[model samples]
Target chain A: MAIFSLWVINKAGGLVYQRNFADGLAQLTSNEHLVLAGTLHGIHAITSRLSPIGASSGAQVIEGESFKMTIFLTATGTKFVLFTSLHETTTDSVLQRVYEAYADAVMKNPFHTPEMPIRSEGFDSRITALIGTGQS
Target chain B: MTIYSLYIFDRHCTCVYYQDWHRTKRPKPAVEGGILPAVSHAITPQPLPADSNAGSTFTSPRNTLTSTSGVVIAVNEPISPGPGLYQTPPSHQQTQANPPPSTSGLAFDEEAKLVYGVILSLRNMIKRISGRDEQFTNYRTSTYKLHLYETLSGYKFVMLSDPNTDSLRFVLRQIYNGPFLDFVVRNPLVIMDSKERGIDNEYFRANTDRLVKGLSVFP
Candidate 1:
């Protein structure tokens, strides 16, 4: 599975972390990333009302022609968004693995503050090791 | 499987015609009350399973009739053990708390606008990211799946169905080419893209309703 990029949004709709793996997507400015994250946050809230059922899971997967976005929302409102190639169907497992790495390496670190931009070295290495092995 | 609703938007992004089959919670303008707060202070809506059917209101299938003052309790929530008549006064306290609207249902116009906004922004985002000309056909949440069909003339027909069902964009297309064309585009009396008026008329609504209800997925 080819994961194009990843974004981690805090509960308040701020882009805490973002990284690109494969390079098929058109690049965006850093400011644009924040705009996109905030837009997604608002859109997620809106999409819930679109559900036919009274209770709903907001935008879970949004598919384009080239890539698809799978969003995983934690109970406390943190969002893990992954951009993957259209053929990659195992996004759920990848998101779970990433969440595991984040919980252990990032959350446990003393230097990392909650809801702030994550700059943990342990988490960085863990993600690279966990995901880097899949690529050439 | 159940088909919940269909919304048709014209080229100018106005909701031309709307119909619903089995949506329990509809858009309503809440005037005065603490309904919104009561809902938040108590139970939050968790996603129903993919197979959830029409009239299967929020929360558990066992206690479906247990709606209290516009709020629904979660499945694991303990019912009062004191007595059968003993009901908690959660509603009394919330209604006194700085009254937001008692019902948090969206207004009909606002709901239509929100639906259009979602598709418009999503379409734009898809174009910029993929840099491709292809339009998005379908997307799914845990509770429901939305199938979108766009005509060359820019009419968008969106249908919300059970998440377990397959893509039904073809159904939307059929509605567009059949009833929409016959009652709206072909009729000379109906004005095209009128700002204040909708394309919804007796003939269009009747035909569309028949077509939707006749589908194999309709319960």
Candidate 2:
């Protein structure tokens, strides 16, 4: 039931926003973060391309020792990645809430410059609150 | 439903446009002068490592070579000279012109700079963290909300409203897709990089004003 972090990646494979909630993960340098995002994007693309049935959407989950990652891609190509405990099964609802928050706070904001990193306090607070409530 | 102001900054971190409305107290005149410089300083991009692969993907084709170097020289002078449209009077001048009213205005300027700096740093940090291109939408404080809408070419539209104000990102996008693209970005008469520091087209202003005012919650 513990959520570690959330990340939003744009169509071009650039990370737009990321927030950490639980604190056990090792910290990464900025360049490492970029590399990680690019790698994930590449892997996602490759996974879709190599799908046995044909080019499907993308990878949905990556289970690790410490946490499990769930990825959801929007029709518009935006990707939402959530890292949570292995026991958490409600990742879909979390992603849905995150998408709604993105649309309401980020998409609806007039000052959000396109293709830049997200810095919306409203979005941050909303997501944090969501995770907090979910954990409790 | 008080809308304090709006500011538009280019990717280069230049405060190209600003306007304030329905505020009882305004920042001091000196405070206004520091905004652009502070924003520019706050937005100064960190030099990327030579081996950085992220740099290649992060760079946009629309950004000119000079902009990448981060030393922006105004290529064209702002077309309009009318101070009426550009200048905002100092709030303290209405009360006392002598010893400079208390530090509230200066404090406000610092707060504004802090907010802008937070936005810029958060943007950069997100890029590093996510390893993908992303855009910020809006931020809300206890007392105020800051909404941002950015174009692909890196033009930023910003608005500050009361905390309870509904979404204004659509309005910003409309302004961008409509009057901004049609009149300023597309129109040859308007120079985005000029010292004039605003979209001087009357048609753009008029239409944008109409759009902003048309918002249901706007005071």
Candidate 3:
């Protein structure tokens, strides 16, 4: 599982965080990022409301032939996204581990604000360590 | 016959007048021309019925003067300033826009400070409602670089970054307009007014664009 980027959107659809990993995406302006955050937040909210209870939240964990966008929940009701793109691999364990890492590194960080951008150095170091160790 | 009337003019310049005509007559005819006394007296100031005051209290603070035909004037005198519950800081050209050497020389450090200040301010705003501080520890080490620029109209924009994250720098601009500007500036409780203290808006707006462009993800 390779996490390509992350984004945080407030309840009001404002983008609080946006990041890209593994590098294939085009660059976007800060304003564009904000707009994307807002739009994604809106879509997530609508998806949640339309979800059938006792089922997973409408956030999709798609494992296409080439890429995936996994949306999961943070403790403060914000979303954590980890995107991965690969030609061939089993993504189940990668996605789950990524979620766990996020819970530990980002959500549990006392310095992290809900619905705000993730900025903790510890979170970054831990993720790099995890991905680095696995790569070797 | 003479009549006094209340007339309403329409948008198309048509006038609709409501009138009660009167004729001077013998005292015996007083009962027959009963409308004059009642109408004239009603036209003069009299205590209105209790229900009249119930609807609304929007008083027009202007005196209406009737001049020649098709002419009307509403003169609204300027209101005197209220007592000094709040004092306004004198207006001046902002120095932060062109900050002195002490400020501009440390532009890099200033950008970092802006990020920290903004984050702390945001956290405080949220904490006012959330009442929790658990997230503070994780957010502390995040590093940011900022750049600022001023538009020709004197508005400022700021670009902000957190280097460890893959996200690009974000930009913020002043979206507030007139009355809201007054609310923040004229408010006595605001310790740093935009015009006087020059810290809040000038710093943030001026460097937004530069900050956004300067963002670089660190290894």
Who wins the DockQ comparison?
1
- Residues A46-99 of candidate 1: C-alpha lDDT, one tens digit per residue: 676566557777889887767888999988778999988877877888889999
Q: Order the numbered candidates by TM-score, best leading.
A: 1, 2, 3
Task: Pick the winner on DockQ between candidates 2 and 3.
Answer: 2
- lDDT (0-100) at residue A55 of candidate 1? 70
DockQ of all candidates, in order? 0.34, 0.03, 0.02
Candidate 3, lDDT over the whole model: 0.34
Candidate 2 lDDT over residue span B174-217, tens digit each: 98898788888888977776644445456776777787788777
Model 3 Cα lDDT, one tens digit per residue, A12-90 = 5556556555554445677866765554443443232211111124334422223444555545555555555543253
Chain B in candidate 1 has what TM-score? 0.65
Q: Give me candidate 3's TM-score against the actual structure.
A: 0.32
lDDT of 1 at A125: 85
Native-contact fraction for each model?
Answer: 0.55, 0.00, 0.00
Off by over 4 Å in 2: A5-136, B30-102, B107-115, B195-197
lDDT accuracy of residue A74 in candidate 2: 87
Error of 1 at A131 (Å): 2.7
Cα lDDT of model 3 by residue, B137-188, tens digit: 1111112222222233433333222323421212222322322144434555
Instruction: State every prediction's TM-score relative to the real structure.
Output: 0.76, 0.45, 0.32
